[model samples]
Target: MELLQALQDRRSIRKYKDTPVGREAVEHLLEAARLAPSWKNQQCWRFLVVTDAAKREKILAGFGDDNPGKKGIAAAPVTIVVCADPAESGIENGIHYYVADTAMALEHLCLAATEMGLGTCWMGLFNEDLIRKGLGIPPTFRIVGITPLGYPDQDPKPRPRKQLNEIAYFEKWGEN
Candidate 1:
């Protein structure tokens, strides 16, 4: 699928079918993430693919009951934990590049999933410490975000977005 179509089609999928995601599709998504650019090619991103029901339950423990993504995490056939090794990337101007690097990779994975007719919801706002302990993640790696992967059960309409003029400028800020 074209990049723009994928971008337009991608949604924060919250409902998934009981169907299973194929291994090849999962690998394809991971490959898309692995090929993403990184700070000085440090490749700080790491993905932990969780498919076991019990393990998914363990990860779900990190999320509060109010989190809408919790149900998706429980329903999807796969949950990819996006992680990053901060030391592997650079930092400048009080900004951490590792987070940016990992986020781009996760976006790539999400787009790929969208192109493949799969669904994903980029989710944060969970208890990182609980997730780290439950998933047995190493101390050096930070859990940046996670997404549930499977066939979408619902056809949600596109959400509203700000106009380009409102968000972007020609050459200067506030000069749209």
Candidate 2:
């Protein structure tokens, strides 16, 4: 699909089919993230692909009681936990840069997933500590986001977006 088309069409899919997703497809999606630009090419992002049933349940527990993505986490064929090493990416002389760099990589992953006929949701409202422990992630790495991957069961209409004029500014902060 065209880049613009994918950008416009991709939505946060919460419902998924029971059909299984292949390893190659997952690899392809991760490859997109692997190639994403990072600060000084530090490549601080790390992905954990969770497929085990028991483990997936544990990860699901991290989500809040009312989170819409809760079922997506449990039912999707796979869930990828995105992480970042603070020592890498945007770090400069003791400052941290991983947050911005890792975020870019995650965006790349989501866009690639959309282009590949897969569904994804950027899950931020979750228990970080539970996730780290559930996935056996080291304490030094930060849990950036989680995304469930599968064939979408529902085709949701696009959610409302702010007008470009409301968000965009010219050379100056308030300039149109």
Per-residue lDDT tens digits for candidate 2, residues 96-131, read 778777778888888998998889998899999998
Output the TM-score of candidate 2.
Answer: 0.94
Best by TM-score: 1
RMSD of each: 0.8, 1.8
Q: Please tell me which predicted candidate would have the highest lDDT against the true structure.
A: 1
Clash pairs (backbone) in predicted model 2: 90-97
- Candidate 1 collision pairs: none
Q: What does the lDDT read for residue 123 in candidate 2?
A: 89
Candidate 1: residue 31 Cα off by (Å)? 0.4
